[model samples]
Target chain A: MRKKPALWGLHASPPGLLKYVLAALPFLVVVLVYLIASDLRHDVNHADKLLPGFGQMLDSLKDLALVPDQRTGKILLLADTLASLKRLLIGVVLASVFGLFLGVNMGLLPGFRALQLSFVTFFSMIPPLAILPILFISFGVGELAKIVLIFIGVFPVIARDIYLASTQVPREQVVKALTLGATQLGVIYRVVLPQILPRLLDTVRLALGPAWLFLIASEAIAATNGLGYRIFLVRRYLAMDIILPYVLWITFIGFSMDWLLRRYMRWRYPWYERGGN
Target chain B: MTDTLASKYQLVIQDVHKSYGEKKVLEDIDLTVRSGEFCTVVGPSGCGKSTLLRLILGQEDVSSGFIYIDGKPVGLPSTDRGIVYQRYSLFPHLSVLDNVILGQTLRIAPWSARSKRKAFVDEAMVYLERMRLAEHSHKLPSELSGGMQQRVAIAQALIAKPKILMMDEPFGALDPETREEMQIFILELWDASRFTVFFVTHDLEEALFLGSRIFVLSQFYTDQRGNGQQIRRGAKIVADHHLPKTPLSAETKRAPHFLDLMESIRRDGFNPAHLQHVDDFNLRHPDSFRTLSPGEGDSQSDRMPQLWDKSQ
Candidate 1:
């Protein structure tokens, strides 16, 4: 037989130090590209507003995060972080609660499913951003509207995910639970609920990206404080330094949220299969 | 006498019939499972054995007639009856210990369970020890072997002390060697516990080896309804035999009589061409009876002229 090329012949997941390096390669490339661009841009104009030097970004970060804002005596980064986190928390938590309730109940009880499946599906399909104006008008441009926007963006997705998860808890488990002396309510809350909780955490982790998107969009549109509002606010001055740091901060925050959820699920439900390595 | 009462055929199905729209599934199944009896049902594929099990489990309602458990009509699945499926025999999410304790935990409130946690675990441990799953109690179903998982499933079901335990091809997923080992293990468990089992399988040897009474369900039986209406044939118990109860081993499967019974069952119910008339079905169990109503259930019995003589 002819010798096949190594790469074309077979492949398996990279192991050991190679895996770590492979993971870091993209980040390394991104930083290298940006460094060269920043160096070139700064060489052209000493006070360039576009693509500020790395030192300038560090200075901006130190100023916003470490130093108190001259106007309000609050650290700008901390203030923005706190505000955005509060809105995200309120929105995501409420959405999760509502979604779990509706989704599981709908899945378990056919009558409830018949009543809500069509409505929930239709609601889920509606572009949440399209109704921002209506929400702002009705709930006001304050915390309510922002939180509602996040809730609207995320609940349907989580609901659908949770519905699918709960419904797929398997007929064998249901019958087994019943035969084990579980009442209808006991089967739902005890048997089915425990089985789907890990799935709930997983769905919530996936919703984080969209949750951030909705939070930022809402904040950018109308908020006086928050990472999105601050980023947009600094844009007029072409403050790429502040924008870049803030963008990185947001990415880091989203990454942390996902990691923390995964960790929690693993810790609490050791039997949960993360599926991906 | 407790012997007479215990052997009273506690589970009775009278003239049961089931259908899905125009397609009938189980027709005129008059089954009587004696109390403290291990009844194994064998059938051809697509012969409605699973449908019959579902009806008995009360997961699905019977289309006609009634099912009685200890003279009381059966409702939806309850702790009175338990099931072990071939594939999903155990909850994958729960630990072996939790799976067994779950039977007791369901009845007690969470507060009470908290107070009685030690007691529950202790009780569950007894069954685990019997199942040889004691050392693996804290592990999930995925961590165990297929036979071990099934043992845990049986322990979980038996923990509840159900009156009847239904196993739907519980050993179907095992390799042949493992299956034989499991058969012996189950027989041991049966000897110890004596919980009435309604075991269903497509394997005739499995039926003969595992059961005190074996019922053969098939769609190959002749029906009075002519071929004009495109009538979909439903599964019926064509032959019910009472086997000798003994302290048996899987090795008994190799005996001549065992193979002979297996062969006869295969020819009787598994063959497509060897269609036996409903009246001539070889139902020979002592407790077995023809409970079918007139016309529907070979009502005329021996009075009718022989359609096809069995004594060739």
Candidate 2:
């Protein structure tokens, strides 16, 4: 009897090169379809607004990135990116700090949990986009409003996720820490907090999508400069070239942030991914 | 009299009863452990062995009773009672060295911990070497094998110099070979340190091998409460034997006397069908005692003649 080959069943795993090819296959197909669609649209109309050709997009990218704005004398893409990233960075950092504090305390302490759990649950349930007008009205249409919008949009979810993660930490660990002479606060801050930080980063990575959504929405509503503002600004003239690249740029930034967070989690907390405790 | 007795014993658990809402877990548990004694508890699964350990550790409050450690009632789990659980004994976030030194670091302020880091590391390294885990000090707990992790946990607990070290099936997760190895290692550690140890396991052989005094806790005994559906009797110490602290050897497990004792304990504690009368429990240990509540053992007098006749 001959031994069976291993490649096409439950026991089969794809080889390394095949695995890479499998991963890239769908992405390549999507790009191919988009190119074909762009060509067909351009053939019908020389200046197609819906699906701009690659050359048209490339020219717009150069203009937005390299050329200075006529009125402000600043490069629009760079300025917008900086503004958007500043808001995003401030909002996410604040959310992470406050979320970690609230979430860990709520999970570790009964009094904190009883006080904040229901309130956070209710707060997280409110659709952030629905409260956009309220945020603008309360904080005004400045940078504060945009940052607040993103903060409100992301923090509660992060807090709740971190709360769940914190609670998932074994009760045995808490008892062990206490037995080790850790004070109540020491157990929370030193023992429980370090263990949950990787989970917090994971929560932040998940919350980044909603953070970007809120950033774009708020910037579209009212902003002089931002990635979202530029996209909306170009949309008025039906400049699909600028809009598409700006959207792609936002995606790239979000993807990179998520990737960086995952990498940092693995690097800093080597035990976390390995399911240490 | 009680004051002197309490002072004499390293740990005194008296008339301890634990219940959760409608379910009773432990009843009338009275155990007095001396300093440097290895008291091992064995029982059937869900026989409330771990519950009794937790109550002594002050991780949970007994429904009614007092657990005094060093003549004082235990309030919350503290450095006085260091525990090594079967799993999750060491913090995964910390390296082996950090885990061992955690007890000292936690007792001190952050700045002091930094300034005294070298002294702490040196002390922890001593324990690491003792546990034969010196080379793995820098590695995280996850990187080590099961037995090694447990060794690290033991080192972590020992560094605290707890009044009574509690281990709840610390070797339960290891393979048989590793478990045997750990048993020998712990016995040596206990012999050298002479710390009061309260070890709980479901393994009868382990209890017999490691304990100076072995307690068989079970819900498998008869009482005035009877076998009615409503009679919710919790586990009690049905048998407590004072075993001689023989020289540590795996070969001793094959001894005829050891096998006989193990067999009798299995029948007494693990056999639900062979429920010994409460009045006739084989509590042979000098420190072993039980408090009988009203009507707990009252009817056992009338049942004794019937039991004797049935056996004859």
Candidate 3:
């Protein structure tokens, strides 16, 4: 029950810190493999075979050997991973903004709740990938369509959960607000929405998973960029090293977003942790 | 003629009648709650005590009659009146301060309002301090205990500086000790503000402890035509006579007259009218009249309409 400390410009507890370190384990292993391969390839500098660097690196690691292969390729893979991470981080930031706006509005307003729940539920029920073709057809091979798909996939679920949580707030409280002479907007913003924001964050944490999945799916189909497309491109040549870095990058981004969101939830809504009775 | 100098009265209900379809709940009910008086309306469950309160607060409409606040007929809820329900009707999302300030935000002056956030916050803090809910200012409604939450609800209502306060069984759910404490706290609060209170309760002791004048609603009866109607709805003063005009002693708790007044309301006005059938009257001996509570007298007088001859 100890509180998590705010550290390193990230709101994370010891466990969250541990989780980040653990997530980096796979990349560390990749780096170790690259280092060993370079050490072996360096020993065979005059070799005429393409596989010498990899094969020698594999054999040298078995024999405790040192060699240098082309180091530039590994650096390129790291750069690609960083670029994908940046894109996803940007994507998540945009999604969070859109989700919070849509969710808070739908959750806090009765008329909006009634108007939106049906359509939002309808869209959410359809497997996000099922609509990929429609997205590809309409906004083919564009990042706009992928971002829009992510926005649609994330916003509705978050909005619906937040709307229900806010609306389901006890009738007595709403009456209490009204009786106190609160204007309609005051009741919603001051009285109603604050109570719902925590629950909305919870929904966002859940929706982000599907949001990432959809973003990856859409990128794999249409986008010429992003980890999803990059990973798919590497698969044709069985370039596991290239694909592995992208996989590690995507996982890192997802985990970081989840952690960041949860951390923010804990800070902004401490009552949420106590279950608020 | 008995007009209060500062405020004539908190509420004046003139010939109020409430009907749901063919069923009549309150008929020709006239009541005037004077400022600074704590008025309790006691009745059996479902006798429209809550409906009466709702009508006074302008939450529900009266089929016929005028509900006036300080001589002004009110058609909608206004900040001048505050209400507490038996159940804790607190907004669970907002902190105690936010809930208290929710209503006042609308009335705050625009110039100082935007800039002087501290003033508004300080005002809310003052009310929270008064309610002893200062520590819970940042806690959500559900995080507090039931009693604390109820206090917050009361605070939320009072923060608007309402002229009249209405309560429907506000302490009906508390244990005896908590209930007594709440009653005393409310009385103290009322003494400070001296706002008129329209309190409803089924507990007779609660009625006597809090109410300056207790009005008991008789049980409703259905006519042969299957119409559910209030019994003697016009007769709010059936036992207003039992209420003593002189100041009561601090030891009024042990006084016989106080007990007698309560017994009368219960035996005659409440139990017989609400529970016992009219045909069962012959089971009692003639000498039972001496032992009967004052409430029984009203019923007895009503039953023997022929024997109870009147000039009218």
RMSD of each: 4.4, 4.2, 10.1
B49-116 in candidate 2: lDDT tens per residue?
99999999888899887788888989888889999999989898899999999999998987789999
Error of 3 at A102 (Å): 5.4
lDDT (Cα, 0-100) at B16 in candidate 1: 83
Q: Is candidate 2 or candidate 3 better by lDDT?
A: 2
- Candidate 3 residues B1-312, lDDT tens each? 214311555677665678888776875565566677778888777678788888887777988766778877775666777888877477554577766776676555435556766777898898889888898798887677767777887887877777778887889888887887787788778777777788889888778767777877654322222323444432222333223433433355557877877776686456634433322322131111111222233355445544432211
Report how closely model 2 matches the true complex, as a DockQ value.
0.81
> Worst ten-residue run, lDDT, model 3 chain B?
B285-294
Candidate 3 residue B245 C-alpha distance from true site, Å: 9.0
DockQ-sorted candidate list, best first: 2, 1, 3
Which one wins on DockQ? Answer: 2
In angstroms, give how far residue A77 of model 3 lies from its true place. 6.2
TM-score of chain A of each: 0.94, 0.95, 0.66
Instruction: Identify the superior model by TM-score, candidate 1 or candidate 2.
Output: 2
Ranking by TM-score: 2, 1, 3
lDDT of 3 by residue, A145-191 (tens): 77767766776676666666665666555555666776666666666
